[model samples]
Target: MSRNVILYIAMSMDGYIARKNGDVDWLEGDGSEPDADIGYDEFYGSIDTVIMGRKTYDQILTFGEYPYKGTRGYVYTSEKRDNNEDVEFTDENVEDLIGKLKKEDGKDIWLIGGAGVIDEFIKKNLIDEYFISVIPCVLGGGIALFKDNNPEIKLKLLKTEAVNGIAMLHYAKR
Candidate 1:
């Protein structure tokens, strides 16, 4: 059976994943190489598909290297455009896209993104699990990591650890 959507992200105490302009240079330098790899590799290896928003896709593009291999990525957007043949950008309804993904034989789905994208998914109650690492630092305001409409989310904490002045929390929706 294919797994559902999983949100794997790193955030600050102030809830900003990056600066207002999408600059995460500080995060790039502060992360522990082994811990980062362990967390990322674990999530990526389990996910069969990844769904991201346009802004998140653009941010990843700026990095100049695609980390997605063997797994399919679908970018949800209201506008129509071409973003490489590898990435599929669709303006279709969210449920439709999710339904399509459910039919495919694969591992879990990854919900990688900026706040807006994550919010949409959270609001729709589509995210099944959230793997969050809280790093040290307060970026006051930028973009929130996870902002939902008081959706009554109950998280069953599965793991915890401190790496480089940070605390990682792995939770599944219950």
Candidate 2:
């Protein structure tokens, strides 16, 4: 089976993934349903690998416990540092790495966030699908989901749903 790269992330209504200071505290909702994960569990189950940028990896580390313990995780970074046994750090060319992964035998890959990594993958047209959850708030200034120099790409809406004030959008490359 061919592997695919899916960009699954959440961003504010104004397109910011996090505040200017890299704070994502605004992702939290106010007194919302306890099970506000939307379709995260299902989406997580569909992927066998997760790739994210250094900053995103650092943020996940602050969560106390590793959230992606069961999956193969990779952090794209050039800095030399120690990481969890379950995670691998690489400064390899993103396109080449992703191409190799896509040819290997495994489930789809999940492209986790932090604008730099996402922008790199987007520039190469490596993402096959997008599962974006648009939160109900707007951040006036911050890192955007798509950076300023991104190439224009079109997507076909596969599905869309609203739950607990979040709009979940699923799209496929057109």
Candidate 3:
């Protein structure tokens, strides 16, 4: 059996997932630097599949000319989308999605997100762990990942890494 349902996201210090208008240049360091965070690379390599909301998938599409390698990624959405080798779009709710995923023989299932998707999984008690990268900057106003958290949640710290003024906090649900 495979371990399941992990969420991976990089958030600004003030808890915003992106800037007010959805810009993230600040987290990228200077204009010409490459995102060479080894920890994140290693983590992504471990996952066999990726699942994300339609908006997040679209946002990823807007960046980079090449394809996302290794894993097959699924976009969670109700509307039909053009099928591609890299992406599979589905509108199934999280529970149904997870149930269907559990039947597939795979390694870690990654929830690449919009805050709403992550919040929905957490609220449904379906998320297994949270791998959060805390970028060292604050966005006064923007999209937040925990905006609808109704219950206080606790995390068991698994490890920490400091790179590019970012704190990679690995927390498992307690």
Candidate 4:
């Protein structure tokens, strides 16, 4: 079977993934204890590869150790960079890269994002599944999850759930 490209991300109720400055400190739940699972472990296990934009990769580096250990990572960037044990940086076209990966024998791919990569994938209609977790707060203005001027793509809702005050919505291409 073809590997699906899933956009698994959390966004504010106002549709912002992070603050304008790229701070994600607002992704907390209740603050009563440590962060809840929110199905992350389950979802992470279902994917064997992760794709992200250059900025997103840089941002993730600030978080200390890489979170995706076993999964292969691909970082889209124009500049030349050395590959590491965890991820390979490539300047390949979005459509071409995704097409090749889909044909490979592996589990679903995670389209983890920054706005640029997400916008490209959405425009190409390459994403197969979307797992969006809506956080409780609203960042009046920030990095938007969806950019303007993109073609309207329809989706079929697969499931919905609430965990730790966050709304999780699963949808697939229609």
**What are the TM-scores, per candidate, against the unseen true structure?**
0.88, 0.94, 0.86, 0.95
State the lDDT of candidate 3 residue by residue for 42-136, as single tens digits.
87777888888887777787897525666877788778788788888877777987888889888888888887777788888887788888877
User: Compared with the true structure, what per-residue lDDT tens digits does model 2 show for residues 33-115?
Assistant: 65666888898889999999999998988988888898998999989977677788988899889878988899999999879
Question: Considering lDDT, where higher is better, how would the candidates rank from best to worst?
Answer: 4, 2, 1, 3
Off by over 4 Å in 3: 29-36
Task: Please write out the lDDT profile of model 4 over residues 44-113, one tens digit for every residue.
Answer: 8899999999889999989998888889999999989999999999989988998898778999999999
User: lDDT of all the models against the reference?
Assistant: 0.78, 0.88, 0.77, 0.91
- Candidate that would win on lDDT: 4
Q: On TM-score, who's better, 2 or 4?
A: 4
Candidate 1: the clashing residue pairs are none
9 Cα displacement, candidate 1 (Å): 0.6
Which is the leading candidate under TM-score?
Answer: 4
lDDT of 1 by residue, 1-174 (tens): 856888888887888898888887656325555444435666677877888888888888788887785668888787888867568887777777777788878789888886777887787877888888887778888777867464777889889877666678889888
lDDT of 4 at 115: 87
Clashes of each: 0, 0, 1, 0
Q: What CA RMSD would you report for each candidate?
A: 2.3, 1.5, 2.7, 1.4
